[model samples]
Target: MNNIVVKEDVNLPALPNTVLPAISELTAALGIPRDALASHEEIEYAWRDLPRELREIPSELRGELIARMCVAVSVGLFDGAMNYIWNAAILQLRQKIRNFSLAVVAQIQQNDFEEKHLRDLQDSRLLGLCLKLNIIDEDGFFFLDQCREVRNNFSAAHPTMGTVNDREFTTFLNRCVRYALADSSSPKGVEISAFISAIKGARFIDNQRQIWVQRLTSTHDAQRQLLVNMAHAVYCDSATAEPARLNAIDLCNGLSTAFTSSIKADLINTHCEYIAKGLEEKHTASLQFFERLGLLGLLDESEQHVIFSRAINRLWDVHNGMNNFHNEPPFAERLLELSHQGAVPETIQDSFVQTIVCCRIGNGYGVSNAAVCYYDELIKGFSPREVTDLILAAKDRTSNLGRRIAGVGSCKRNFKTVLNLIDTASVPNLVRADYDNFVR
Candidate 1:
C-alpha cells in the first residue's frame, strides 16, 4: 500500500452542490463512529478526491471523471445514498467520454483510500483498505502486516517511557476510534488523540516534545490539554533507567520554561498523577527553576524519602555492586542512581518488571537504555580502546529516545553523576575507564 500518493491532474470538475448531510451519513456507514469536528467541507477537502473542478480541466477532462469517481466512492463507502450518488456519478463520467483515461481510472481506483490509517505515521490506509477490499489477504497476519511499521516505530522507544502511558494513550486512542466508528461525537478529541498516538510513533525523538511546545504556543486549550496528557503519559510509562530519568528531567525542564514558582509545581501536581513520581527524582531538570524561586524548600522531609526510597529499590542490584555487578554493571549503576535518587520501597517489583521489557520481539533500538546495557555486555569482549571507539561510534548513532543525552542543565547534572560514579569504589573499575575515555 502506497502511504504516499500524489494526485496529478490538469482539469477541474464542475463543482457539485456541496452535500454535507450525505457526507456525514456516508461517514457513519463507513464504520467511523465519531469525529470531533468533521463536517462536509472538511470531508471534501481531506478526501483527496478530485474536487468538482477547483480548477478547469484542459482537453483531458480528467477533473470531471475524478469528481464523479469521488462521489461514487463516497456513495460506495456510505452504501444506500453512496450507491445512488456513485451510480449517477459513474453515468456522468461515462457521458464525459473524453475523460475516460485508463490511467486516471486506475489512479482513482487505487486511491479509494482517502481515509487510510489517518494516524499519519506510515500511510497505511492502503494496507488496511486492501485487506478490507479483498485485494490483499485479510488473513490472520494482515493486521499484523498492516501495522508492522507502526509496531516497529513504537518499539523503538525506550521501555522506561514504558508502554504504560502508551497503553493508556492507546486506550484513549481506541476510545477515539470508537467515536470515529460509532459515537457520532465531535471529531476534535479524535483528531487530537490520533495526532498524539501518531506522533508517538514518529521517527523523531522530540516529536512529543514538539507537540507539547506547539500546544503551549498555540492558544487552543484543548490542544494544550491533549499535549499535556501526552507529556504526562511519556513520563508515566517509561521503564528504562535513562529515558525515564530524562522524561522526569524534561517535565521539569518544560515546566521551568513555561511556568513559575508554586504555580509550576501546582500545575504539574494538579494535572499529572505522576507528579509525585517525578518529584521523587529530587534531581529534576528545573532544579534551578525551583531553587531560584525558593520553591525547592517546599519539598518536605517525607517527600524526599519516598522519592529516594523508590530509586533505592531500582538500585537494589547495586548493593552488591563490586564483583558480580559487572554482569549488568550499567543496570547496577542505573539502579544505584535511581536508588540514591530515592523512591518508595520495592514492594511492587513484579509489576515494574514488565515496564522494562521490549514491546516487540527482537526489536533493537540502539540509543535506548536497553541498547546501553547491550553495549556494556558486548564491550566486555573488546579491548579498552575498542570499547572506547565503540562508545564514540554510538555517540553519533541513535536518537535520544525521548530525552536528550545531554541538556544544558541536565548535562551538568550528568557530569556530577559521572564524577560521583567514577569516585564511588562500588562501581566497576571499567566504568571510570569508560568515562575518562568518553570525555577525551
Candidate 2:
C-alpha cells in the first residue's frame, strides 16, 4: 500500500450544485466528507464555542495547536480532534520544562538524545515526567494520561480501533484546554513574568513601586519564586544595560529578605561572582550595594568573605583602570582596607598575598605608595607560611625591576620590619637579601 501524504495547499474538486456526495465516498477519496470540511473561518467560530475561561488562554501559548484542534473538531473528525488536543497539552508541558531547566532545552536543541531514549518517552511518559517535576499535580497528570490514551486508541494518527461522537469530543477538548493547556485562570498570576522583566529593564517611581510591591507580596510563594528566579537571571545577565543592572539590583534587594536565609545567601553569592568579573562601573555599583546590604544585616559574614575576597583579587585591575580609562581609581586602597576588616577565604589567600607584593614593589610613586598605609593591616590577615609563598611569587614577578627597583628596596625594608616586629612569636626570622640587587 502507498503512503498517504497531507500537502499544505490541498485543492478539493467541487461537484455540481445538483449532485449528492456520499459520506463514505467523500471520506475515502478526499480524506474528509464535504459536510465535514469546514473553512478556517468556520473553525474559528467553533473555537468561540469553548467556555470564556478556556478561551482566555493566551494565543501565544500553543496557538497553532489550538487552531488545529478547532479545525479537527469542526470537521467531525473526532479521533483527529483528540490527537490535536493531546498535542496542545504536550506543547504546554514542553514550555514549562524549558523554563525549568535551560540545560535540558540546550540538549533538546542539540538533538543530544539516543534514538531509543527518544522513543521511550511517549506522550504518557511526557505527562508523567512533568508530574514528577511538580509542573502538574497528580489529578491533572492522570487526567492528561487518559486523554493521551483516547488519542492513541481512536485518533486518525493511529489505526481506527474505536470512535468518539461529536458531543463526547467537544467535552474532551474543553477538559484538555481548561485543565492542562491554559497558563492560569487568575489574571495577576499571568502577569508575574512580565512584572519581572519590567522591573529589570526600567526603574519604577515611588507610587508605582508601592503598587507592584503590594501585588508581589500578596501572591503565594510558589508564584513569587518565579519572580525571584527571573530577577536573578536579569541581574547577572552580561547583556543587560548598566542602568538596567542597577535597577535589577534594587528590585532584587526588595525581594531578597522575603526568601529564606539560605536562598538569600546563594543569591548574594551568585551576584558577587558576577560583580567581581565586571569592569569599574560594575565594581562601584556592586560595592555600594553590598555596603547597603551589610548595613541592613542582610549580608552575613560568609557572604562578606566571598564578596571582599573577590573584590581584593581584582584590586590591581581597578587600580590600573581598564583599557578605556587611563587614570586609576582609588579602588585598590579601598579594597585593601576592606580585606583587613574580615576573614579572607583560604582559597583566595594566595591571590591576595600576590597582589600586595606586586603593588608594594611597583616603580610608580602614585597608586603604589597609596597602598603603603594598609600593608600592616593587610599582612596581619596572612600567616608566616603564606608570607613565605608571597615573597617567592614577588621575587619571580619583579626579577628585573626597572626604574621602580630603586624605591622598591626601601619599600621592601619597611614591609619586612613591619612583619617581623608585629606578632614577633608568629613571625619567621627575616633572611635579609641585598637591598640594591636582591630586594629590588
Candidate 3:
C-alpha cells in the first residue's frame, strides 16, 4: 500500500482588498487549502474577452462604473464586480430619472437629499425606486432582484460560502449591463391625466376596474405621478363630494397596491420624506396627504416606523438649538396620532417611551411647557407600566439634565404634573412617595 499527501499553497498576501472578513474567517475556519489568489495581470487577461458594455451609460456614471468593474475584474473579485454591475444599472436609471425631474435633481445636487433622505441605499431599494418611478419595467426589476439575491448570498459584503465560476460570473455581468442600460418607455404626461380623469368618475365595476388596472399596470413611471397628484386632489379638494373622493382614493390605492411589496414600501417611504419636506416648507396640505395615506392603510408598519422616527427626531431638530419648540408639539402630537392609529408597533411602545425620556432637556433650557405637553401626548400611546418605567428611569439617571427633567427640587412641580397624567394606582409607592415628598 502506498500513501500520498498533497499540500495546497496559501497565498496570504495576494487576497483582494474587497474580500470580506467573513469570507477570510470562514476560509480559515474550514482549514481548506487555498489556491494562489489571482493577480491583477492574470485577472485582466481573464476578462480580456469580455466586451465593453458600458457605452450606453452616461459619461459621468460610465467612467466611475467602468473603473470599479475594471478593478473588481483585475482583482478576480467576482462578487464585487457583480455588485458594481447591478449598481451601474441602478445608477443609470436614477440619472435618467434625475434628468426627467430637473428640480428634484437640483435639490439632490444642492445636498437637500442628505437632510431629507438616507443616502446609502441598498440595491433592492434603488431598483425598487426605479420601479416606482417607471424607470424600469417589472420584469427588469424582478430580474435585478434575483441578481441582488446572488450578491447577498455570494458577495464579499456578506458571509457566504457560495462560489461563482468564470462562466456564471460573465453571464450575469452581461445580463446586468443589458438590464441597466436598456431604455424605458415612460408614458406621456397627457396620457396619465386622461387616464386619471377617466377613472375618477367611472364606477369601479368589474369590467371598468379591470380595464383601468390593466392600463395602470402598463402605464410608464413618469405618468404614474399623475395618479399620485389625483389622489392628493381627492383628499385635499374640499369641493369633492365625500363619496366621490373616497372612490377616487380607493381606486388610486388599488392601483398602487398592485405593485410588489418592495416597490410598494419604496413608494411609501419616498412619499413620506416628500410629504415631510413639504410640511417643513409650510405646506399644511402635506399633513392631509399623510392622513389620507393612513386612511387608506397604504402605510405598512415599516413605513409608519420611518414616518414616526423621522417626525419625532425632527422635534428635537426644530427645537433643540434654536429654542424653537413650536414644531415639537405638532410633531409629538403627530407621533401620538400615528400610534393611536396603530401605526407604531406594540413592541416599540417601550422604546418610544425610552426615546422621550432620553431627550436631553438641558439644564439652562429646562423642560419647556411644550416638552411637557409633548410627552403628555406621547405617553398616552404607552401602557401604564411602560410609562412608569420611563418615569423611574428618568429619576434614576445621575446627570443634571436628567435630574432637571425628572423635576428634582425646583422642578418638582413639573414631575408632579407628569405623574398626575398617569394612573398613580398602578405606579409603585416609591415613585408616588418621591413625587409627594418633593412637593411637600
The number of the candidate with the highest TM-score is 2
What Cα-based lDDT does every candidate model obtain?
0.35, 0.55, 0.56
lDDT of 2 by residue, 1-440 (tens): 95553223222233323323333466559776454543334443444454443354655654676667655554546677678777777766665655554343233234553435434567777776566445677887877777777777778878977676655566667667755666532213325445756676566776766666666565434545555655656655566776666666666567656775555665566556665776554444444555544422445565566666666656666544543122222555565556545555566666766665555544344334545556545666567656555545545544422223334665455545544533534444552242223423
Model 1: residues with Cα > 4 Å off, grouped in runs: 1-191, 199-203, 206-215, 218-226, 233-256, 260-300, 313-316, 321-440
TM-score of structure candidate 1 = 0.23
> What's model 3's lDDT at 425?
60
Model 3: per-residue Cα lDDT over 224-334, one tens digit each = 544555555555556666555666655565665454555445445555666566544312343445554553256556545555666666755665646555445665666
Model 1's alpha-carbon lDDT is: 0.35
Compared with the true structure, model 3 gives a TM-score of: 0.34
Better of 2 and 3 by TM-score: 2
Where's the lowest-lDDT run of ten residues in candidate 3? 5-14
Per-candidate Cα RMSD to the true structure, in Å, reads 24.9, 18.7, 20.9
Model 2 lowest lDDT segment of ten: 6-15
Sort by TM-score, best first. Answer: 2, 3, 1
Model 3: residues with Cα > 4 Å off, grouped in runs: 1-46, 55-60, 100-115, 118-121, 182-440
- For model 2 the local lDDT of residue 365 reads 40
